[model samples]
Target: MNKPTSIRMCAASLLAGLSLLLSGCFITPGKFTSELVLSQDESFTFTYEGEIFFLGLSSLAQMGAANEEFTPQECYDEDTFEDRECTEEEIAEQRAAWDAGAETRAAEAKKKAEEMSVMMGGIDPSDPEASEELRRILLRHHGWDRVEDKGNGVFDVSYSISGKLTHDFMFPVIEDVPMTNPFVQMIIRDDKVVRINAPGFSAQEGDNPMGGMAGLAGLAALGEGASGGNGADEMPDLPKIEGTFSIVTQGSMKIRANNTDEGPNPTPTGEILTWDISPRTQNAPTALIAFGQ
Candidate 1:
């Protein structure tokens, strides 16, 4: 196979392997602005504006699986293990092999989709009505002011909620959606300390599952269709990781720990911690604060 073909094959295999490890449910942050405010009196408010993606139901995962079927067989030199052109007979043989296994692969794919549907509360990602169903589900929640289905499992949404910090709080507590990972979380400890973490805002692998998928998809796109050819512009648009996350605290609240580059900056309201998120952001935003006795 040629270089472009080789790259596509490798990328497809990598995506297939990753899909196995990931759950059927994944919610990740896209371009957006998010903020959290903690007061000295234990009151809090949070707001998020931008895109939220459902990876499993998106074309990203589907494309990864679909590409595998088109991967051409590659032949190598026996002794040197270097790439070599295949004989016509060898090409024909490989083609025959692929055709023979088509049925088996199709059956396997169907079975996997069924399993994923069960995992996602019987909502089938492949179903034509799935996107509208998800939109309706999100609109039923309190903070979702607007939920626009952008197709391919991405939604442009606005969410804002406020309440006293008497219990732990998590953004995107959607009904019927499996709790795999949260975009933001605030945990109130017994000693009145509040720990904040925003994992979905980062591009790190462990921090956001979509980040890893986006990286792989980018690599896969580098093959023929993406380089310079008739299909160059036909490549699917990949998800972008860009956002701003801020945490504001009352001046009286004690800051115990944080991971911002410049730490907390003094503000008239109190102190502010900000993270400018991008594809290169390796660590998620985090902070720890406490109220006075």
Candidate 2:
């Protein structure tokens, strides 16, 4: 589906406007589900020492992992990479595991999102000194603009501001406070946003400077961890999150989708394509925390 040139050109201009669409909604059956469409396909990019991570809001990793064992290998073929129909036992077990995982992740994510929202509310993003200072430290030398918002849980954010970036060195003690995970970044287009960017974190082979000592050093560290050592503490854990969610079928509003094949029939259709982030989270535990090691 070829989008009009105007829609493509006006994408950036549309980001800030769609952030609040979720804030204002009505709950009417067959009318309003009171759900918000993620305005962006992904969330903000948090770069630490050149490693880019995504922010996730859904405890999808936990839930998916919890339900993974229940899925028969036949349900997930490696060759064609197709998912076959599941048996009753698989469905029941997977549902139970997923349900349990959802409760844990949702509770954690909701609490964090609310806390960040409150903190942001207290701070004046408009204050020149405050905003500029925050933009420098938080966004890392990036300028920012507060995009207007609708009542939904979404809001516009602009980091590409004009002019130089300068700020004071005064640091607040509260600034050191740890924030929750799954920070979402929305992408907008054509006065409407339909995607979200979730943040994540990962740990790879730690920096080993010594040539022959490199592999040996890494092995020793692994030994320490195996011997109940805190070797892994030097790096952060992988954060899990829902990549981006959308309503396949529009309820009350008009459905404007691109790349959708109005074909005759296919076995499976719904492909919740998740972004393959840099660091992959563990696939075992259905419930886990990334912070505090």
Candidate 3:
């Protein structure tokens, strides 16, 4: 073989090895991209009873929701045993128990936020000079007015969301996913989004895994408005659930919307990018974007 060709081959091999080393030494592409999920919503507070896989780490922190709806409905299903209807006093006791549980979860979520505040080294998510780009995105698209520094990466996101679900029966959908929150406080370090977690969501509607009237009934037991989530239960006011997500800077983009209005849900359809390269005519570099499967 020609000497030049042999030298070129060796260079390619060396570059490949370097890429592998850098990924392991710092963070893998998968790990880095998953972070995009953090920026998408802003909070990651949910029950951590299961394993969490994001941020290149097996787990970061965890979240807990109020168990105020454990009404023991299934306990009396098979009435071969002498089971009697719960007395009014018993019902009151059960409701109080659930309320207490919800309060406990709320406190735990606040503590986690505080810990994350400590964890993100006190980077203010609302600082205009801090995560300026993110702030702009919120303002332009979602009307999230601003962020307030709570002494950490955590910031109180203020926004107004007004929409109605058209349905004959009052149902609930995911106001926030079980794992991510809308009023998400974000911490940016080295120009990346981090510390995605938030409060225990007070309510949701329609499409929850724990579905049907059971879930709605559970929420309604909270009181006059916690069930269907009143107007005050809009976007900014309610506590939110965190989701498992990732971000890839300028990686790939996917756009899908909820299709519950239709008879059935349709698959997410969009331009799918399977390679990593950009054209140079416009003088732009790629950015990391989030993706979900």
> Residue 6 error for model 2, in Å?
32
Output the TM-score of candidate 2: 0.21
lDDT of 1 at 232: 41
* Two-way TM-score contest, 1 vs 3, winner: 1
Model 2, span 148-212: residue lDDT tens: 22112122233322211121111111243333322223334333323332321111222312111
Q: Who wins the lDDT comparison?
A: 1
Better of 1 and 2 by lDDT: 1
lDDT of 1 by residue, 175-264 (tens): 766666677889988888889988766665574444434443444444333344433444455467688999998858988999999999
* Model 1 misplaced regions, further than 4 Å: 4-8, 17-24, 67-96, 206-234
Q: In model 3, which range of ten residues has the least summed lDDT?
A: 25-34
Error of 2 at 250 (Å): 59
Give the Cα RMSD of candidate 1: 3.6
Candidate 2 segments whose C-alpha is farther than 4 A from its true place? 1-74, 77-83, 118-293
For model 2, give the 10-residue run with minimal summed lDDT: 26-35
Which sequence of candidate numbers ranks them by TM-score, best first? 1, 3, 2
